[model samples]
Target: MSHAPVFDAVIHAPGRLQICAILSSVDDAEFAMIRDAIKVSDSVLSKHLKQLEEAGYVKLTKQAENGRQRTWIALTPAGRKTFAAHVAELQRLAALTAPEPMGQGFAG
Candidate 1:
């Protein structure tokens, strides 16, 4: 199903957008993996995640692996839906500004 286009400032930020993009395709992603994918420092990723969490768009879980604690991240259902809508809106707006087809705008 197609989602209605809607602009979401929270999800639109560069780091957050990248996080959402990564999370959108997976059931859950490891914290380090996401940080690596986005090429951000741990603190930066943490900050971005905090904002997303506050917005109710992401969920964080901790699990024990071996002797270390690993954190996993996933997008909430609301996040998935909202992200889809935001992407649709971006596409819609992009299409509006896209150049006309070759020769379509020619006056000659």
Candidate 2:
């Protein structure tokens, strides 16, 4: 039987998916850190983050440290679980799509 592709929507977008992956690996990170990790412009990251936050996938907290303002980002428990499942599904898709050795399938 054939299997449908996983991560069809939210986790499929390149930028957002990258953001989710980065957040999944860390406990909590600052805006600058997440922006740098994703290598996206400030405005771009902000827009994407806002969407994630609204969807209840991420939490953002603004605080002051040593008189400096900082915005910290973290994945909620639900977000973590979703991201983990998305990643696993993507992995399975990759493995299934990979080219097999000779005699694996009919030639064109």
TM-score for candidate 2: 0.79
Give the residue spans of candidate 2 off by over 4 A.
Answer: 1-8, 100-108
User: Across residues 48-94, which tens digit of lDDT does each residue of candidate 2 receive?
Assistant: 88878887889999999999999999999877777777777878878
> How large is the C-alpha RMSD of every model relative to the true structure?
4.2, 5.6
TM-score of each: 0.89, 0.79
Best by lDDT: 1
Best by TM-score: 1
User: All models: lDDT?
Assistant: 0.96, 0.81
